[model samples]
Target: MKTLMLILAVIVGLALIAGGAILIAINRNGPAVLDTVDRISGGKNNTELLHKQSLGVDPRQKLLVYGERSPDEALPVFIFIHGGSWRSGNPDDYGFIARSIAPEGYIVVLGGYCLRENGRYPAMLQDTAAVTAWVHENITDFGGDPERIVLAGHSAGAYNVAQVALEQRWLEQARVPAQAIRGVVGLAGPYDFYPYDSDSTRAAFGSVGVGAESQPVNHTSSDAPPMLLVHGEQDSLVKPRNTRALAAALEDSGADVETLFLPAMTHNDPLLALANPWRRDPRIFDAVTSFLGQHTALSVPVQAETP
Candidate 1:
């Protein structure tokens, strides 16, 4: 049984975040824009413990939990990572994603990981794995079932989750079973960028010395979990080829992979669709929820027979 929620009393549109004004400027101060939106979203929904550290090893890590939990029932967990070129972004700012999904009968976790001073790729991967492992061990306290966990992320965060799911060592290091991750959802992620040409890519991975080991595309196997790779055909930031290459590799390896290439979407469109007002844009959230449902997370709890 899912926890109860009343969509609250706020109007559902841009006006909700526009502060009684019809026109809001997006080109100005992105932080302020998100702050306004987060505040409104936070109020309308049950945003509790907007921040918390994982079990112990990583303190800089933080996370936010969305949705209420019923004492007698365990819902499958959905863990989401944020995009910031692996250098920027805070969990508090990304609650809109959790807000949109948690209402659909899932315990949505907006997880954050430590980024050391000039930290490279595997460090984030380790923290993400640790967070996932910790959630698996302890989310029962929050009414989440450990056996059914789905991972999703956007851009750099997308790369993080996808890589963590594809590569065995990171989760293995954290002592989490690979099968615990039921599926992966990546939005505008760079899965095959090896040369490291862009400033963001070069800074986070250039020190890695041009290796495919850090790339998720090279790690596909027949045993790989199902994946939904979404990219904007119009995305100039990371390019749609990243998703294409990874999907092709997974297909060749006899793995289950699906893709949504939005011809009109930019890098941020898929992400924006997860927030209020834009959630009805279609394909992104619908495809993800549908994919995750095919796994263990979306079904109704099995009721034990009375003797």
Candidate 2:
């Protein structure tokens, strides 16, 4: 009895420590905008061109596509969502993410999302699903494979990825198959965060805690797509345990999930690095390429016909 009691006590203590750590991380101030702006802008390549096109007339939402040239055949498409505290950010902020992965034979789509000011919860989710559906229907013109679409996001963007991937309704309403999602890459996303009494968080996230109906972990099952969860060990924003907990739930459901935690990097660093490849953690590129390679139908690059 004494031994068992001691073990139980240890377990409870560890849980409390972990919970405290996550709150601290969520409260972290992240980095200054100037720092990220300088890091992202300094590494531009004049040789590579990024094409900007409007997907629709939302005024707030525009599609920024990146690649060497228009794709001729069905190629893997990565729809990247930018992270802002669900308040501020634009498609331009994440154009670098699309560029970094385009060379690997994937079309990168960067677009804006509705903010808390515009709406919240299902509204943002609906906008994300709308973009996914639009890409699936029209990306063929640009040589993107609708069947191999993948969702990649960071921070709040990460959280949105989890929401759509786990919950079937958003994608279903858009008429996009849930099975069509090949993979998901969530960077420092809050998978399950619900503080019922905290009005600030509740206003944005309501009573749905991490494992609640709205949380991604709640929807993990064998049929869902594979997920890659990455985090920073020293990150004081979004917390590593969020990813850890989501990974555990995914594993329990027999889902193929992987995690990579960077040593010294922080929250915004990963987002900035996704654009300026040289400044990013190599593991970020490696994991993303590996995921895309797994789902692509063509083992080798499709060759264009000779003139």
Candidate 3:
């Protein structure tokens, strides 16, 4: 019995040490580690094309602009929002997305927003709206056509993009016309989730009196911009039902909506596929570029090259 107890205590001590090390690594060198991994895996490129610019008074409210080296030509613009479960996420992590898509003759902007811990519900929505308005007003100087703007997001970011597109009030408050958004792309987004079963959802939306008000599915309208909803078949995190239900709602409202379900992909696979040039599944990239082509008038075909 003493021998067994000693062995168990040793295992527990090792586990505790490992856990502490991981926490310290995450708190201190997480971003650098991610950057290093992205570089080694060929997931990072076109960084020279990225230009950092401030959007508001808060330094955290800045964005990275990709493409538009030539000021003479106006290009379609795509604004992307990264997802981190409404708790943590940074625009820097998604730089590969802009690098992958910008060469396709579109100016891409990756923006950051307030997390649920910082503020709830409308906080993220408001930040995205402000960035969108800023793009509409100033993107012209950066060679982007303000009239041809597409919104794209992954996971929680997808939820924010869809919410702002559907609710209209959020953009209206920012003085941006709802109709200005030409298209939307959502990957593994939670659109119909309700009842606030999880702590993240509860913290982000439980305070709202009407649960339906928090759902993008409840805000569908015929005038909504064309939307492309992509989900992983094996995504247990957000569930395929979210995409199906939102597509149904958009269809019922006479809105243009397209749905694609990738076989054997997890919650993060779809977004990662955007960064990975050698991804086996071509559906995600094909669907996104195709959808943008059909909706937004691209000056040139997407020539996104693998690094």
Number of the top candidate by lDDT?
3
- Root-mean-square deviation of each candidate, in angstroms? 8.2, 12.3, 8.5
Candidate 3 vs. true structure, TM-score:
0.82
The C-alpha TM-scores of every prediction are: 0.83, 0.77, 0.82
- Highest-TM-score candidate: 1
Two-way lDDT contest, 1 vs 2, winner: 1
- Give per-residue CA lDDT, model 2, range 121-208, as digits (tens): 7666777887788888877777678888889888888888788888888899999988679999898888867543344346566733
Tens digits of per-residue lDDT for model 1, 188-223: 999999877887777777866647799999999999
Task: Indicate the worst ten consecutive residues by lDDT in candidate 1.
Answer: 1-10
Error of 1 at 126 (Å): 0.7
Candidate 2, residue 11: the lDDT equals 100
lDDT order, best first, reads 3, 1, 2
Q: Is 1 or 2 the stronger prediction by TM-score?
A: 1
